[model samples]
Target: MAVRGFLRGIGGKNAMPQGASADGSERPLKPIAMGDGATRLQLLDEFEAGGIGWFWATDDQNRLIYLSPAAAANFQVSHEELIGRPLTSLFTLENGEDEEAAERPLPFLISARTKFANMTVKVDAGGDPRWWTISGKPYQDANGVFLGYRGGAKDITADFERQRDNTRAAHFDSLTGLANRNRMTRRLTAILTAYKAAKRSCALLMLDLDRFKAVNDTLGHPAGDELLKQVAQRLERIVGPKGEIGRLGGDEFQVILPDIDDRGDLGELAHRIIQMISQPYSLDGSRAIIGTSVGIAVAPYDGIEPSDLVKSADLALYAAKGGGRGQYRFYSNDLKDSAQQRREIEEDLRDALSRGELRMYYQPVVCSQTHKVKGFEALMRWEHPERGPISPAVFIPIAEDSNLIIALGEWAMRQACEDAAKWPADMTVSVNVSAQQFSTDSLPALVTNALASSGLKPRRLELEITESVFMGDAATTDAMFAKLKKIGVRLALDDFGTGYSSLGYLRKAPFDKIKIDQSFVRGSTEDDNSNSAIIAAIVSLADALDMETTAEGVEAMDELALVKKRGATLIQGFIFSRAVPQEEVLEKLADGNFVYEPNGPEKQRSQRRTLFRRIGVIHEDHRYEAVLRNLSRTGAMIEGLLEVPVGTDLVLDLGEGQLAICRVRRSQDATQGVEFETPLISDGADGLCTRHRISPYALAAAGMPLAALPPGHYAMPDRRGARPTDNRRFMQVDVGMGASRAA
Candidate 1:
């Protein structure tokens, strides 16, 4: 309507009269009553000069023939300089802020000579970003020959930028500056859908901060927020462009790693994340240390859908935390069962101490030079009435979570002190103190009571504390150390190199010894590893501080020899002795045999996971049931295939879509050892799994509905339409028929 009203002055039918209409009296002229071409041109020039809107025209070649002086000034150039410049060159289609609006490219619209209205575009003025809404129509001569376009445009930069800010705030975490929960979910869903078509893979990682609640409770929520910000920054540095990380609120974070399915690489990255996050954080003049447990799942292998994948990763994360707070686990089908069993374990553990299911075992920490027992580290073990032995690794974290560790730890400490008083006077006992137990004020009083009740000298009761104890409140930690030192009980730093190692704290904390973690000891003998150097540095640091060093988990003579050579003052592992029961400790003390000889394997060998589970053995078209007795990265042992040739190739159907191609390296009667064609990778736990699995999409293409891999064997359907009648060459023996044969 406004344009029509303005156009009336240019000789349109609605033009008003300017003067008297053939009468004596004069008539009032309309505001824009232009009776000549010069007046109409003057009005148009004034409109352009007012910067209300600007006109532009292009020749048939889409080159700018004329632009209003005001609009030309917006580009910071003279109108003459912009003349003959390609109109499309001066303005480009806006980045697709709105998908529908950018569907038609600017060049395509101009070349097609179509009428376009209110198209959002960016003006290529060499300054801050400028956005405009342009409306244009194709013009032509009376003969219908096209003469390009005439358009008017107005700047919308401010409005467009404001809208973009709103979009960003909606999709991103305002505090961490990372994508928020909504954005991460949408991104994961989109990537999985796209990757499903391409048959590619994406790995999802779910991590929950360990002991984060303690930080909040101790230092307040503001400090917790600061700690979270620091954690986000660390994650960004580590993940960078490899993946997208998002905080799912509170202490939970998720990472989406595209094109990454290999568990080995994922495990490495997860370990790095755990290590980096476990380091102490300085927050508002207070120190807070925290750890993370990560769980990983890969697309099509773990699950085909977003929810399933997330659930799988979450299950893995639960397992990691349950195993121990500072670790990572990859998804497996058994985790669901484990998750259920964990809840039961937690319930059972609440009453374990009263039921007498918990007992203390002592592993000897020997003198490296004399091979004599110097002291013993008291370890806790659980023996469920029906389930028998339960690993501390499986139950300790549960106790910590359930707040049973304080009571349980007190019980173990008292028992250790009582038992140590009866042992040879020269020998000492070391009991582990958990971070949860140390955080309470009752620890020092409990230690004092344990010593007084057992009549054991305070020096004989060594309390081993991990690096996590230094998490928050440095002054409090120092006070605790002072109190313990005043009580005359020795303090040994346990798991020294397992992340959170800081020389700054070591300078003041009164520690009597440093226990090198098993992780460093396991690979110290390898020529390619730097574990040896790390061990040397730690031992030297301990020696300089007038402290002793104990190399933990030395199960091989070579590892023991390496640690001893590197000047470790003590050794504690299977190389000397496993943690013995109280009865055995008493029996050994009566015999007066304080010396322990190195009794492990002469050299380190590849660690193989020992288990007895049934799996399928496939030969040609026949699949026979067999027992998988044990498995390693490179090979496995099986039974029930009688007289199979040693060199014959076979496929081992380890269920859940995992198939291992192997050749029988050794065969004898019903027993055979096979070597894998491709060595399996770690399953992020204490097991091996194939790096690649039969995808669920492929299963769907084979007439099965798409879903997460089920617990049964996945075999190719028989396309021959009939079963082959070939007789079996090898007998399927019942290896478990030992009772009948003996009868």
Candidate 2:
């Protein structure tokens, strides 16, 4: 069997030729008897055809054989010369006893063959190291024959290099050639787990670029992308060997510093990051500048788990952003509260309109000269069921920023129009329009729909637009105003003196009214030179344009007087009245005797007289029986048991079928104020009074006393005519005496 194996090696092929026998017979080995031998022969032929050389040899005992082209090439010998050489002599062993370390010898045992047993051996050709695979088998005869060793070698250097490149790409950032998020996450997870086990501290710092979008928008995306790459490089330099830096995403990065020395290290890192990122970056021959805000979460203190640490870091990032950019913040509990509050407010604002918690209140705008109600300006108010009343000063800016003002404005228009429908025909209602609301093309449609639904006359509805409304494109403003005017809705320029371009707005827009801002009103009352001049100029401009002027925030009587003197047609302020409920407005309207007195000593006296007269008349009527009282010009007081609510208008019947209309000025217990709506006496009744022999006393007592009495007859003085005590002086003296007695 050994001799046959040696002969097979010398044959230089895996199979015997046809018509030959395996027993050294002249007949060749049959194809059916060749068990893998044919495939091996084909593999060898293909290798040789491809310019690969081969040789075969037997081990020292001549029991096994090895075949391979690589062996001849390594020995720097031709395949024919190496054919029958001893397999052990084909290679040299550095150490005889170090069998495991020795190069895999040829003619190795077949039973020991492994799928991929890699080995390196030095060949005689320049003594170069050659890699190989050695498959070994035990020698046998006939069907059980096994070769000593058989293997094939292929160059794997290029393949190994390609794999190395792929591994690098998978772990590194392509742009900056630094570690990427995946690699960073893996490393960070391992570090965090190890640190937690050992109870050590570490810090995770998150850095985000501020105003980076602005750079991208203004400088183009290429410049922006370049800037990010430069930022990553800077971060890598700053962190150096102390920590690992990674590009988490665009304009965002993360740094992990494991085994921190002290808390100061975190602060130092934060400062370094800020300093490095804040520096200007040059891109495409142009300089670009941006800032970075960093958030740091420390292990064992901020969080124990990786997810918790990341969350805390994110919270800190939010805090850094909140405190303005270009700064760093550490994780803290306060940030959690702030985040929660912001979320809640944002959520509530989104649902505010749907919740139906918003309302509009109308405050009367009175004519400065006539002291008559001219119009009402609708103001929005928000009453949150949970948060109570939120000030307009607080929520208005928020709404504007969030683009919620558009919906709020629409709601206000609809509500104001509905409320205006309930007012007198002549009274107009004005609604404030925000710049955002006016910018919408749907504004006019919204207004038109509101008017149609509320049955409010278009001419009686006014829109108060701020100066900012006209600050945009002139053509747009002109078109908008034209559309609004075409709808027959009056326009008023509100806060006329408060804005920078008020005069410009006024000149461009044809407003029916110009409202002097409250700041001007407040300042004008104090005789502020600039504010007063502004007001005067506005008033003059209004007069020139045939436009009415309204003064807002007229808190003092002097302000009202000044506005009236300045020819302001309307006045709205706390002095006249604060905004009240609809019922209160109706009550004020019914109280025809109600008069506004300016602030002063004499004004107080007159107000007291008015108050006492109203109270006395109503109270006397409630106390005395069969005594009808009418507010006459004289002092006579009549009493009857009746309840007249304050501000109630009623008709009083005097003797001889005379009647007079009066409104309740003051309540009698639960009674209302009264005012004279009509008088019983007419010019034609003079002769009738004289023919009836009725005296002027009854007519005078019924609130119809004339300074120059018309020609009339006399009536019974004691019953029908007013008694002689019905004198103005007597009422004044009685009121004075009653005041003194009460005191």
| Cα distance off (Å), candidate 1, residue 88 | 2.8
Tens-digit per-residue lDDT, 456-495, candidate 1: 9998989999888888688888999999999999999999
C-alpha TM-score for every candidate: 0.91, 0.38
Residue 189 lDDT (model 2): 80
Off by over 4 Å in 1: 1-47, 76-78, 96-104, 716-722, 725-727, 738-743
**Each candidate's lDDT (Cα)?**
0.87, 0.62
Query: What digit string (tens of lDDT, one per residue) describes model 2 on residues 346-369?
Result: 568778889888778778888787
Residue 346 of model 1, lDDT score: 94
lDDT of 1: 0.87
> At residue 354, what lDDT does model 2 achieve?
90
Candidate that would win on lDDT: 1
